[model samples]
Structures are given as C-alpha cells and as structure tokens.
Target chain A: MTPQLEIVIIAVIVSAACSVLGVFLILRKMAMMTDAISHTILLGIVVAFFITESLTSPLLIIGAALVGLLTVYLTEALRRTRLMAEDSSIGIVFPFLFSIAIILITKYAGNIHLDVDSVLLGELVFVPFDRLIVLGRDIGAKSLYVMGTILFIDLLYVILFYKELKLVTFDAALAAVLGFSPIAIHYSLMGLVSITAVGAFEAVGSILVIAFMIGPPVSAYMITDKLRNMLILSTLIGIINSIIGYRLSVIFDVAIAGSIATVIGITFLIVFITAPKRGMLTIINSRRRRKIEYAMASLLLHLCNHENTDREEIESNRHSIYQHLNWSKKFLEKILYKALNLNYITLNNEYLKLTPKGREYAIRCYDDIGYSI
Target chain B: MQKHVIEVEDMTVAYEEKPVLWDIDINIPKGVLMAIVGPNGAGKSTLIKAMLNLVKPISGKVLFNGLSYECQRRYIGYVPQRGSVDWDFPTSVLDVVLMGTYGKIGWIKRPGKKEKEKSLDAIKKVGMEEFVDRQISQLSGGQQQRVFLARALVQDADIYFMDEPFQGVDAKTERAIINILKELRLRGKTVIVVHHDLQTVKEYFDWVALLNTKLIQYGKVDEVFTDENLRITYGSTDRVLKGEV
Candidate 1:
C-alpha cells in the first residue's frame, strides 16, 4: 500500500478506537482524565525505553498503560484528600507526572529517537514509514496494526461490559450496590484508555489522541439522546473527522494529526451550534421564546387584573401595562406583536384586551403561581 | 442464625475526624418495612451507609443475616439518592431497572430473558411500565423515584436499602412508592428507607428508627412516633412534627 493510504487508514482506525472510549469518558465526565493519561503515558514510554533499551518493545505499551493507571490512582488519591476539588486534583497530578516525562526525554534520553514534539503534537506523516512485515512480506503500517488491534480490543471490552460500563458511568453508587465494583471497572477502563492512548500517541501524538477521545463524543452527545446512539455516532464522527482531516492535511500541506484535531474541534463546534435539541442555538432560541412567552403572559394577566375593573382602568392601559411590567419598549412591542399574531390579545382603543384564549392561558399561569383572580 | 435482618453493633462514623454518627446500635427484624427518620445532619444517611458498608465507621461493624456485608452482598439492594447521579446519562428506565439483576448475572454474564422479565414485572408493579423505554432524564422527579424503586425490586434481594426515596417527589408518587414498599414487605423482603416526612411515618412504615447523630428511639411506629421523641430527635420545638402522632 502507498504511504498516503497507510497514513489515512491508521488515522481512521485510531480515531474509531479513541472515540469508542471517548463516549464513556465524556459521559463519565472524565475527559480530562484522558488528557492526563495521554500526556503522562510519555513517562511510561520513557521508563520502558530505559529498561528495555528498545522503543519498539511491547513493554513500552505496558509501561505507558501502567503510568496511565498510576495517573488515575494518583488523581483519585489527591481528590480523596478532600483538600482540593476533582478538577483541581486532576490538574495537579497529570502536570507533575508529565513534566517528569518531558525532563527524562530531554535530559536523559536525548540520544534516543523519542522526540517530545512528536509525542505531543504527533508525527502522523512519518506513520506510514513504520511498516509491519510478517514472513518477509510487507503488510501495512505498524501503527495501523496496533491501532486496529486496540480498536478491536476496545470493541470487545465495550460489548462484554456495556451494561456494567453504563451502570458505573451513570450511577457508581448503584453499580456498587449491584455487586459490581465500580472502582475495579473504572481502573480497567483507565487501563483501556491508557493502552489506546499509548497505541495512538506514536502516530497521532498525545494532544490529537485526546482530541479524538473527547471531541467526537462531545459532538455526538449534542446530537443523540440514547447511550447506544451516542456511542455509535461518536465512532462515526471520529472516522469522519479522520477522513476530513487527512484530506485537509494533504490539501494544505499541514500536519495530519493537527489537521484532524482541528477538524474534530470544528465538527464539535458545528454540532454545538446547530444540534437540534441541545445546541447553543437551540438553547438561545428557547430562551428567546420563553422571554416572549413571559411578556405575553404578563400582558394577559395585566389585562385580567383589570378585566373585572373599569374599562378605563390603569392596569389595562397599554402605556400603564408597559410601565408596570418593567419591559423595554422594543421588547414590549415585540411581545404585543407576538401576542396579537397568536390571537392571545387584541387592541381595544389604547387598552390591551385579553382574548378568551389569552384569559385561559393567564389563569393557568396564575394557577402555576398558586393564586387565583 | 440471627433473627434480625441487620445488626449494627456500636457503629460510629466520622468525616474529617468529626463524628457524623455517634455510637449506634440498631437491630432490625426480618421482613419489616422500616424508616430511618432524623433532622438534617442527624446522620440518618450515615447510619444507612454504615450498615451497607458504603461508609466506614470509626468504631463498629454491621452484620447482614449473621454474615458480613462483603460476603452477603447478593442479598442486598440499594436505591441511592436520586440527585446523586447525573440523570442525563442516556439510559432508559428499563436499562436502569435491568441493572438490578447484575448481581445475579455475575461476572462476564449478561442479564438475559429472566432478568428482563423481572425488570418488566417490577416496572409494572410500580405503574411505570408505560415509561420503560423512556430515558431516565425524561421522567419527572416522582417518576424517577419510581424507576429507582423498580430497579431495586428487580434485584430480588432479601433486603433493600433506599435513601430518601420520597424526596422531591410528588404526593402521588410518594403514595406509589409506599405501595411498592408494601408489596416488597408482603413478599417477605425487608425494606429500610431514610425518610423525613414525620406525618407519613405512622401511615407508611411498619417500624421506625428515629436517629439524631445518635439513636433516640426505635420500635413500632405507634410507640416510637410520640411527640416527645420527635422533639428530642428534632432537637427543638417540633414544628415539623406537629400532629405526626
């Protein structure tokens, strides 16, 4: 296979794997833990290199994974101290371990092939060069095989423990009561995250792995309501981000991993703005509608307050209603127009009069406040 | 074998070296629908957690049917506070209820047809079968409480521990919950709840344990639901306990 194909294939495979776990990480509110594990796994790789004297040894993956677990445990330990909050605990632990890894890389292992930039920003362009061969035949990229294997393992882990993962992520206390050790499940998930981060860190880099792990899932979460749909949508979004990012990299001659991260970020942004239910636009639009509704309801009640009073009562006067309601002139006009359009109110001379529908609605609104006119 | 379903031997729990629950000894008989009542910060929740081994007591241990909690975990089910979890977790009511069978399903084993049937039956009993497929977050506060009770029901455990199940729920939902608890008691399962509504204590629970960082009184609700016991447990004039007798 050509190098370009190898790069894209590896990117796609890694994206899928990271995103599968990413769904859980986002739902569990442990997205930062992924960031922590990915960065600190550098220390694991450095340690493994020191012991094994070879970068390609399986011990490297094991070492990085162990460090990932260590990061989780240490963060939990700090959180358990009750000295700091959860986010502070994570913020403190990962940086401490990550700086140690960076020091080891620059100070002790400078002569080694480990480049800190590649570990952080990724070296996807060089991924195609690491060819995996079996029986003297060139198969494909080594990163491709490693990521594909991890993806399968991730798939297996998710399938086997879908219920358990859901239980723990949703309610750790209930999960514990149901005889599932939430701590055990959490650590195992961390182990999986560490392995995935290690596997992809070499190709996409630590930051990009985190992007694939959190970005796609967050984007998917905005779009889907069901857990199953969220997981599936996240995997699909990750794969799409990989493809788009790879294309963008080739077109612009930029870094592939960075392009992918940027693309995934843009994707999340798009979903955040446009998603049907939970998007920023949806929230803003609903708030706008609520404000308008509130004003119109207030107008109806103001009219109702004067409905039994004289026809020329101050509460029913449009100018007085405007003054008493504490609404800006523009907003009041908008509410009046909207109410008139909805046939909730009518203009009787200079007075705001409530239609029957408007009267019913106003009565319900008053009932909501536990009062009656 | 112990006649009591749960026995707490001088349990005392502390947080940050400050005692939350003082030395407390409470022995609960089998198949009783019991309520643990106390004012805020009275360690009502702490006592329940201590018995379930969720909270480590500084000085005492609890026994479930003469066995330690770790050994007899399969016989216990729990409904933690509804507010404890993120409701937007993308799981359905049935999915939550189905988790109740996870203990019996054991490791590496999926909850199969039997578990689903049990979950459905539990949902039906709680009058929430229509909402089985609805996501948990879609349910009202009362409905959420019912869903949790259903999850506990599917556990089929000998004893169920519910923490403030009636909290934030509507009166109708509270009634529904009490009916389900009654059914569980009828089936010879013990139900222990951390409840606060003193007015409903006599009407709902068969037995009551009133706690106040210490045990004030515990027995049949008719005996323990006195005005004085409530005043002492509440630590002042009992405005929250008027006419509870």
Candidate 2:
C-alpha cells in the first residue's frame, strides 16, 4: 500500500478505538482522567526503556498501562482524601509523572530515537516507514497492525462489558449492591485506556490522542441519545475525521496527526452548533417558543381578570392592556400575533377577547401558577 | 414471633474516625414496609449503605437470611438516591430496567427474552410502560424516580434497600412508588427506605426504625413513631420538625 494510504489507515484505526472508549469516558465524566493518564504514560515508557533497554519490549506496554492505572488510582485516592476536588487531584498526579519523564529524557536519553515533540504531537509521516516483516514475507505498516489490534481489543471489551459499563456508569452504588464491583470495571477500563495510549503514541502523539479520544464521542453524544447509537456515530465521525484530515494534509503539506486532530475539533464544533435536538439553535428556538407561550398565557390571564370589567368599551382594549402590562409594543404584537395564529384570541374592533379555547388555557395557567381561578 | 429477614449486629460506621453511626443492632422482619427516618446528616442513608456493604463499617455484620451479603447478593436489590447518577446518560428506560437482570445472568451473559419480559412487567407496574423506549434524560423527575424503582423491581430480590425514592417525586409518583413498595411487602419481600418526611411515617410504613447516629427506635409504627422519639432522633428541632406544626 502507498505510504499515504497506510498513514490514513493507521489514523482511522486509532481514531475509531479512542472514540468508542471516549463515549464511556464522557458519560462517566472521566474524559480528563484519560488525558492525565495518556500524559503520565510517558513516565512508564521511560522507566520501561531503562529496565528493558529495548524499544519493542512488551514490558513498555505493561509499564505504560500500569502508569495509566496508577494515574487514575492516585487521582481517585486524592479525591477520596476529601482534601482536593477531582480536577485538582488529576492536575497534581499526571504532571508530576510527566515532568519526571521529560526531565529524564532531556537530561539522560539525549541520544535516543524518541523525539519529545513527536511524542506530544505525533508524526504520522513516519508511520508508513515502520514496516512489519513476518515469516520472511512483507506485511503492512506496523502502526496500522498495532492500531488495528487495539481497535479489535477495544471493540471486544466494549461489547463484552456493555451491560456492566452502562450499569456502573449510570449508577455505581446500585451496581455495587448488585454484586458488580464498579471499582473493578473502572480499573480494567483504565488499563485498556493505557494500552490504547501506548499503541497510538508513536503515530498520533499524546496531545492528539486526547483530541481523538474526546472530540468525536462528545460530538456524537450531542447527536444521539442511545448508547449503542452514540458508539456507532462516534466511530463514524472518527473515520470521517481521519479521511478528511488525511486529504487536507496532502493538500497543505502539513503534519498528518495534527490535521486529524484539527479536523476532529472542527467536526465537534459543527455538531455542537447543529445537532438536531441538543444544538445551540434548538435550545434557543425552544426557549423563544416557550417565552411566546408564557407571554400569551399572561396576556390571556390579564383579559380573564378583567372579564367582568366595569368599562365594557375599554376593558379588552390592546392599548390599555399592553400599557397596564408594562409590555413593549413589539412584545405585545409578537405574542398577540402568536395567540391569534393559534385561535386563542380575536380582535373585536380595538378590543382583545379570549376565545373559549383561550379561557380554558388561561384557567390551566392559573393552576400552573398555583392560583385558584 | 416474627421472622427477621435482615439482622444487623453491632453495626457501627465511621467516615475517617468521625463516627457516623454507633453500636446499631437491629432486626428487620420479612414482609414489612420499613422506614429509616432521621433528620439531615443523621445517618439514615448511612445505615442502608452500611447494610448493603457499600460503606465499610468500622465494625459490624449484616446478615440476609442467615447469609453474608456477598453470598446472598442475588436476593438483595438496591435503589440508590436519584441524584447518585447523572440522568443525561444515553440510555432508555428499558435499558435501565434490564440492568436489574444482570445479577441473575452473571458476567458475559446478555439479557434475553425472559429478562426483557421481567423488565417490561416492572415498567408496567410502575405505569411507565409508555416511556419504556424514551431516553432517560428526557424524563421528568418523577418519571426518572419511577424508572429507578422499576429497575430495582426487576431484580425480584427478597429484600430491597431504597434511599430517598420520594426525594423529588410528585405526589402521584410518590403514591405510585408507595403502592409498588406495598405490593412488594405483600408478596413477602422486605422493603427498607431512608425517609426524611415524618408526617407520612405512620400512614405509609408498617415498620419504622428511627436513626440518628444510633438506633433511636425500631418497632411497629405505633410503638416508635412518637413525638418524644422523633424529638430525640432529630435532636430538639423547630416546630415543624418537632411534629407540633
């Protein structure tokens, strides 16, 4: 396969896996914890390299995964101390470990192939170069295989533990009472997150990994309200982001990983503004409709209170009622039009009178306001 | 001569050496709708958490039908506080109720037709069958409370622990929940609730256990639901709390 194709393939696989797990992380409000763990895994990588003296050693993955779990464990432990808030606990734990790793790399391992910049902002250009050879036959790009394996593992984990994950995320105390140890499920998820971090670190880098992990799933969360649909939508968004990002990088001659992360961000922004039910526009529209309804109800109530007005000629007059209500002429016109459109009111010459339907609605509004008619 | 379904022996709980509950010994007989009543921070919820082993008791033992909670977990169900979890989670009412069957299916086994039927029946009993497919976040506060009750009901456990099921529910929802609890009790199941309201203690509960960092009283409603005991449990309250208003 072409190097460009290989790079895009690796990016897609990594994005897909991260987005799947990102749904749970977002739902559980642990998305930041994933960021913290991915950062802290650098310390694990440094320690594992010092011990094994080999880049391909499986101990590196184990070490990084362990540190990921440790980051989460320490954050939780700090939170349990009742000393600091959850974010502060994470802020304290990951940076300390990450700083140590960076210090160790700059001071000691200056001669290594591990580029700190590439680690933070991954280099997908190099992904196509790392070819895997098996049984004297040429295989595909090594990063692709690694990311693919992690995606498969992630898919399996999500499917196998869907029920437990949902139950625990939605209600941990009840899950605990029902004999499902939420703590156990949490640690296992952290461990998997750590492994995924290791798999994607070389291709997407630490910072970009978070972009993939959080952005698409959060976007998908706004787009859908079913967990399974959210999962599927997030995966689709990840793939779409990967393809568009790859094509953009080709045109701009820029970093592939950074492009993917940027595309994911843009996608999230689009979803945040345009999601059918949860978008900003939808909320604003609903609020405006409710405001109009509330205003019409108030207008009807005013007319109802003056139903037996002493002055029959001026009682329901719009000018008198609007002035009495302290409402702007535009506001009066807007709600008046809306009520007339709904057949709740009619203009008898210059006076506003409530229809039979309007009186019933007015009575309901009185009860809603905790007042007896 | 009544048979106790739950026995709590020397159950004491402390949060980092700040004693929350002290020397609490109580026996909850089967088929009784019991209310654990207390003022704020009086450890009413703590007692239920301790019994379910969600909280590590400083020193205590809770037995369900002469067995450890872990050994007999299949026979116990719990409905945590409505605020315990975010209702915005991407799940339907049916999915939440289906979780109650997970204990029976154990790990790796999915909820099949039988489990779905049980969950549906639980939803029907809660009068939330119409909302079975609705997303949880779209539900009203009372509907969410009913959904939680249905989740626990699907467990079909011999004993249930509920923490403030009526905390924010409407009057109709509260009545619906009470009816379900009554039904469970009639079917020989034990229902223990952490209740804050004292006015309805006698009307809604047959058994009352007043807790305030200790077991103030545990007996029938007529025996324990008294003005003097309430005053003691709440630690000298305002007129409303003193049950004088």
TM-score of each: 0.93, 0.97
Cα lDDT listed for each candidate: 0.89, 0.89
Report the CA-based lDDT of candidate 1 relative to the real structure: 0.89
- Candidate 2, TM-score vs. the true structure? 0.97
Docking quality of model 1: it rates as acceptable
A1-373: candidate 2 lDDT, tens digit per residue? 8987888788889989998998989998998998998889988988999999988778988999999998998999999999999999999998898999999889878899776897899888888888888998879898888889889999999999998998889889988988889999999988999999989988889887898889999999999999999999999999999999999999999888878889999999989989999998899999998888788888898888888778645668877777887889989988888889989899998899889999999989988874221
| Candidate 1 lDDT, A1-373, residue by residue in tens | 7898888889999999999999999998998899899999999999999999998999999999999999999999989989998899999989999999999889998987898888898898888888889999988888888989999999999999988898889889877776788989999999999999999999999899999999999999899888999999999999999999999999999888889999999999999999998999999999998877777777788788778776547777777677788778787888888888989888989877789998999999988763211
Docking class of predicted structure 2: medium
Model 2 pairs in collision: none
What are the clash counts of all predictions, listed in order? 0, 0
DockQ of 2: 0.61
Count of clashes in candidate 1:
0
Candidate 1 displacement at residue A123 in angstroms: 0.9
